[model samples]
Target chain A: MNLTILGCYAATPRTFTNPTSQVLEIRNRLFLIDCGEGTQVQLRKNKIKFSAINHIFISHLHGDHFYGLIGLISTFNLLNRNNDLTVYGPKGIQEIIKLQLKLSNSWPQYDLHFVELTSTESEIIFEDDKVIVKTIPLKHRVYTNGFLFQEKIKERKLNVNAVQNYEIETCYFQNIKSGKDITLEDGRVIPNSELTFDPEAPKSYAFCSDTMYNEEIIPIIKNVDVLYHETTFLESEVELAKKTMHSTAKEAARIALQANCKQLILGHYSTRYESIKLFKEEAQTIFENAVLGDDGKVFEL
Target chain B: MNLTILGCYAATPRTFTNPTSQVLEIRNRLFLIDCGEGTQVQLRKNKIKFSAINHIFISHLHGDHFYGLIGLISTFNLLNRNNDLTVYGPKGIQEIIKLQLKLSNSWPQYDLHFVELTSTESEIIFEDDKVIVKTIPLKHRVYTNGFLFQEKIKERKLNVNAVQNYEIETCYFQNIKSGKDITLEDGRVIPNSELTFDPEAPKSYAFCSDTMYNEEIIPIIKNVDVLYHETTFLESEVELAKKTMHSTAKEAARIALQANCKQLILGHYSTRYESIKLFKEEAQTIFENAVLGDDGKVFEL
Candidate 1:
């Protein structure tokens, strides 16, 4: 799985910094997360194929989080994109996009679908054969949710040397990979484990932003391969963070440590900070695997 | 009056070109016209002071004309702007903005006033001591109108040298500047023309875009200092222009010529043509004073 960070700043978009937006490529599928303003430009700069993004996951309806969605959709129409696009966002997102289209008197030629999430409880929002996405209920000033993308386990790999020694038929390899014992022509039962090795462990990523420090999401995002948490403030601004329903770097780090994530990506830094090194330094005090998220940075898991 | 072209290209926003948008500075007042997508970034790149823009005039509800408006308004709120902002546009703009604000659950701390235009005939939308803004109804697919910004005639010059030479009292200078006959303390009648030269002639700029070839608006925008008209296509694509309710360069220049404008600024060129020189060349065939509008290019009228 590969993750591309298109933008990873907090609040308003600046010349150097952008609001939250990212692309996760898993199992040959591209999933867009939190498309903020100027996301299409960022996507162009990152050299990502616009049509490859089939699904969009919006965490909330905040302007910085999803203002670019309507523009992007309009651009797709202008470019003559015919593929169906699925948008998973908060309840009001569909209305906003519809209003824009109505006012402009422009409609897309492609099939546009909206999956509004009105549920307050944690649940699976999207699922396919290889991937599953769940919502992580978060505490914020408005109704907001984090996304957890978990890749499902794959089929067991064939043990070539073990298969050679055992006169295994090529036609039976499929059964063996499916973790089933196959009986050979010699009337000998062979164990599936002896003929095949275990499949590689699936990786998972959790995206959380614009939320206060909440331990309630720990169980849902526990032991994630990577966790992107918003650190909108520093240690000195803990009071401000609480008041704004945002998390400080130290608070994000504490959540990362509690979740036992292998790697912690700190993002959504307030515009007040000139540099994000302080957030990394502060997060690392509690979680050694903490890293600062920057625009255009990509990660492979 | 000075006009700064933020973006002039038609249709979609591109890497090197932009959609329709411009800033007209008249009498120290900045008026933003037709804010397309990416307008805020263009404004930042141009180093325009945000606070200086007190009024925004949108030509129509087309996406290429006003897509960036919501983002600009949101940014103003994010910056904690307390000054009142006045937006003038066609009917339904208020509902669009209000819906966005409602979805985001954010109401600006400052007052946002909207002046919706429903008049099909020429009507003054905004007027002050220094400037007057009137709408010039146009033919288009949607409810559209062009804006005419005319700087009011300046107050007569004090004629400091004449006043001192004529031994005129300072109190009577106001009357002299107002073109009134002033009676001096010495019982001498001073003609206003002798005391002061004519004030600077009123400069007018007419912005007509996203409209078909319509000569009906000529009388409304007659004898304007500068006329910016949309030339979405070349003469070769006149059919497409008619189908899209747009105008060709020659057609736009013809309208400018009929209006007897001092200068014609050709803009809103279709993205198909890479070079805008063709637009100017074609327009010059009809109007010799025609010039191509370019992004970031400024014109003084």
Candidate 2:
């Protein structure tokens, strides 16, 4: 799985800083998350195919999280998109989008669907054969959800050399990969363990942002491959972070440490900071393997 | 008066090209005309102070014209803006903006006002002591208005040397500047023309865009110092222009010629054209003083 950081700043977008938005590539599917202003331009700059995105996951209704959504939706219609697209977001999102489209008199020619979220509890919102996305209830100024995307476990791999020792026919290869014993023509049976090996373990990624220090989410995101959490402030501005219901770098690291994720990615820095180095430094002091999330940076897990 | 072109392309924004938006500086006031996506960033890149802009004019309800407005408004609130802001646009604009703000729950601390337009005939929409803005009804696929920003007639300049020669009190100087004859204590009347020189003639700028080849607006914008018109196509694509309710470069020049404006600006070119030079060449065929409008290019009138 790979993730592209399109924007990482908080509150407002400056000349060089953008607001929160990113693209996640998992199992050959492209998903857009938290589209801030200028995200469409960032997509063009990054050369990401617009049509490749069939699903959008929005964490909340804040302007920084979804202001660019309507424009992107309008551009899709302009581009003659006829494919089905679904947006999963908080309850009010459907009203906001439909209102603009209604007033503009330019509704999408294709089917547009919305999976509105009202439950404050964690729940699975999207699932495919390859992956399942579940909401991680987060504490913020508003009702919010952080997504946990987990790839489904794969089938067992055939031990090609070990299978050769048996008189297994080509038609029985499916049974071998399915972790089942294959019986020979003379009624002698071979154990499935001798013919197949376990596939690589499935990986998962947890995305959390714009939330305060909440210990309840640790259990939901614990032991994920990568946990990306918002670090809106450094240790020096802990008070501001608390007042805004945002997490400081130290707080995010504490969550990461408690959650015991393999890797921690820190992002969504306030524009007041001159550099993002302090976020990494502060986050790493509490949790090792903490990396700064910068715009245009890509991370693979 | 100064005019700065922010983005002048037609339809949608590209990686390097932007949609329609511009800034007009007149009488120490800055007015934003049409705010496409990324306009706030363009304002910052152009070094235009956001606080200095109290009035915004949106020509239409199309996404290209006003998609950036909510983000800019939210940014203004984030910057702690307390000054009042006024927006003038089509009838449905207020509803669209209000809906988004309601969903985001971010009401502006500053006073926000809207002037909705639905008339098909020309009318004065905004007026102050130094300038007046009127709507120039244009034919388009949607309801659109072209703005005519005309500076109010300036006061006559005082001849400092000529004024000192008379025994006129400082309080009477206002009367002299108002073009009234002054009377000395001895009842000797001095002609105002002899004591003062006429100030420079008031200059006006007419912005017409996203319109077809309609002659109805020629009289309303006639004899303006500068006329900026949208030329969405070349003469070769006149049929496309007619179908889209957009004008060709040649048609824009024909309007400039018929309106008898001092200068003509051709902009809003379709991205299909590789070079912008062709627009100027085609426009100059009908109007001698046609100039190409480019993003970031400033004009003084």
Candidate 3:
């Protein structure tokens, strides 16, 4: 799985920094997360194919998180995109998009679907054969939810040496990969575990932003391979972070530690800071595996 | 008056070109015209002061014309702007804006006033002491209007030698500048024409875009000092222009010529062609004083 940070600044779009937006590619499927203003331009600048994005996950209704969605949808129609697009977001997103389309007298030629989240409890929002996505209920000033993308477990890998010596029938190879015991033509029972090894561990990523530090979410995102959490403030601004419902770098690190995530990615720095190194330093004091997210940066898991 | 082109290309925004948006500075007031997508970035790249633009004029509800407006407004709120902002646009613009704000849960601290236009006939939309803005109805896919910004006639320059020789009273100077014959306290009468010339012929600029070639608007924009019109297609693609209710370079120039505009500015070139210089060349066939609008290019009128 590969993750690309299209934008990671807090508050507003400036000459050097942009608002929140990113792309997560898992099993060749592109999923857009938190489309802030100027996101389409960032997509173009990064050479990401606009048409490849079929699913969009919006964390909240905040303008900084999803203001660019309408324009992106309009542009897709202008480009004659015919593929159906699915959008999962908090309630009221559909109304916002519909109003703009009505005022403009333009409608998409393709099917547009919206899955509005009105529930405060965690639930599976999207699922397919290869991946499953669930909501991570977060504490914020408004109703908001983070996303957790987890890759599904795959078939076991064949052990060539064991298969050669166990007199395994070629027809039973499928059963062996499925972790089933099979009887060969020689009337000998073969154990699937002896002929095949377990598949590579599934990778998972958790995304949280615009939320205060909450340990209640630890169980939902525990043992995630990678965790991207907003660190809007440094240690010096903990009071401000709490007041604004934002997390300081130290607080973000504490969440990552409690969740026992393999790695931690910090983003959504306030526009007041000139550099994000301070955030990294603050996070590192509590969690060793902390990295800062900047515009156009990418990570592979 | 000075005009800065933030974006002038037709169709979708790309890495090299942007959609319709511009900045017009008249009498120290900055007016943003037609904010397309990515306008905030364009404004930043051009180094425009965001706080200075208190007035925005949207010609139509098309996404290419005002898709970036919500994002810009949200940015203003995020920046904690307290100044009042006035937006002039089509009748349904208020609903679109209000819906977005409602969904985003963001409210600006500043006062935002909207002047909705439903008239199909030419009318004065804005008027200040130094400038007057009138709407010129145009034929398009949607209800649209072109804007005509005319600078008010300036006070006549004092002819010091003539005033001294004629022994004109100081109080009579105001009447003379108002283009009226004035009599001094000593009973000496002076002809206004003999004392002062016409106030430098008030300069006017007419902006017409996303419309087909129509001669009906000539009277409303007649004798404009500078005319900026959309030329979405070249001579070779004139058929496309007619089909899309857009105009070709030659067609735009024809309107400028029929209106007797002093100079013609061609813009909103379709993304099909790479070179915008062709628009100027094609327009110059009928209007010699024609120029192409490029991003960041400024024109003084």
Candidate 4:
């Protein structure tokens, strides 16, 4: 799995800084997250093909989180896209998109689908043969959800040496990869473990943004390979973080540590800060593997 | 009057090239016209203060023409704007803005007023002592209106020598500046034209975009100081212009020549063009005073 941060900031898009938006590539599927204003421009700058985006996941309806959605959709139409697109977001997201399109008198030539999510509990939102997407309910000023993208384990690898020693037929190799034991022609049964090795463990990534420090999501996102959490404030601004329903750098680190995630990515830094490097220092005090999220930065997980 | 081209291209906004949007500063009031996406960022880049913009005029509901409006308004709210904002657009514009604000639960803290226009005929949409804004109906795929911003005739300048020659009383100076004939204390009648010259001839600027080569508007926009017309295509692509309800550079120049506008500004070039200088060259062939519209280029009239 690979993640590219198209934009990672709070409030508004500046000439040099962008708001919250990113692209996650898992199992050959490119999924867009958040899509703040200027996202399409950033996507172009990042050299990502427009047609590669099929699924868009919005955490909330805030302008910084979702304003670029309508523009991107309109751009898709102008590009004459015919591929089906799916959008998953909060309840009112669909209404905003449809209203804008209606006013513009423009409609997509593709099948545009909307999946409005309102549940505050963790639930699966998307699934395919290669990947599974689930929601990590978060606490924020508005209704919000974090997304967890997990890859599915593939077929077990076959041990060619073990298969040859067992004198198994070539047609039975599929059974061994499916974790089935093969019966020899001499009336002897060989264990499937001897013939096949387990596939690589599935990797998972959890994105938690615009949320306060909530421990309830730890169980749902436990042991994720990477966790992207919004650190809108520093440790000194704990009260401000609480008032705004945002997490401080240390608080985000605490959550990442408690969830046992391998690495923590901190972003959505407030413009009030003189520098964003302080976030990395503060988060690293609690979680050793903390990386600051920067626009156009891609991480391979 | 000063005009700043924020974005003047057809189709989607690119990394360096923006779509349709511009700022017209007249009478100490900054008016935003046709706010495409990424306009706010452009405003920041141009160092135009957001609070100075109290009025926004959207030409049409096309995404390239008006997509940046909501984001700008939302940014105004985030900046804690207290000044009222007025928007003039087509009939459904208010509903679209209100619906998006409602869905996000983020309404403006200031007074937001909308003047919905459904008129196909020329009519004044905004009027103040210093300026008058009227809609210039245009033909497009959607309902579109260009704007004509004309400065109201200012107070006549006082010619001290002429006033003294007629022995006009100091108290009558105000009346003379207001274009009223003054009867001197010596019972001498002096014409107002002798007392003062016209105030800069009341400079006018007409913005006619996203329209065909319709000559019916020549009467309304006749003899304007400056006219910014959309030249979406070159002379070679006249057929495409006719089919898309757009105007080519030659056609735009034809309208300018017929209306006797002081200067013809060509803009809204289609992305298919390899170079924009061709538009200026093509337009200059028919109209001598033709200028090209480029993003961030300011024209003082």
Q: Which candidate should be chosen as best, given lDDT against the real structure?
A: 4
Model 1's alpha-carbon lDDT is 0.90
- The candidate, 1 or 2, that scores higher on TM-score is 2
Candidate 1 lDDT, B1-301, residue by residue in tens: 8999999987677667777889999999999998987788888888888878889999898888888888889999888898999999999899988888888888899899999988899999999999999998988889998999998888898788988998877888777888898777688888888889888799999999889999899899999999999999999999999999999999999998998999999999887986889999999999999998899998988
Residues B149-258, candidate 3: write the lDDT tens digits.
98998999777788888877787888788888877677877777778876787888899988999999999999999999999999899898889899999999999999
lDDT score for residue B107 of model 3: 76
Which ranges of candidate 4 are over 4 A from the true structure? B165-167
Q: What is the DockQ score of candidate 2, to 2 decimals?
A: 0.72
Model 1 stretches with alpha carbons more than 4 Å out: B161-166, B183-190
The CA lDDT at B193 in model 4 is: 88
Residue-level lDDT tens digits of model 4 in A56-109? 999988889988899999999989998999999999888888987877778888
Q: Would you list the clashing residue pairs of candidate 3?
A: none
lDDT of 2 by residue, B96-207 (tens): 8888788777889999999999999999988999999999998988899999999999999999889888857789889999999988888999999988999999999999
CA lDDT of A62 in candidate 2?
85
Please tell me which predicted candidate would have the highest DockQ against the true structure. Answer: 4
lDDT of 3 by residue, A1-301 (tens): 9999999998877777888999999988999999997788899999899899999999998878988899899988988998999999998889889888877888899899999998888899999999999999998888899999999999999898998887676777888888898777778887778888989999999999889999989999999999999999987898998898999999999999999999999999997886799999999999999998999999988
Give model 2's docking category: medium
Of 2 and 3, which scores higher on lDDT?
Answer: 2
Q: What is the C-alpha RMSD of each candidate to the true structure, in Å?
A: 1.8, 1.6, 1.4, 1.2
Q: Looking at candidate 4, what TM-score does chain B attain?
A: 0.97
**DockQ of candidate 4?**
0.79
RMSD of 3: 1.4
Sorted by lDDT (best first), the order is 4, 2, 3, 1
Q: Against the hidden reference, what TM-scores do the models get?
A: 0.96, 0.97, 0.97, 0.98
Between prediction 3 and prediction 4, the one with superior lDDT is 4
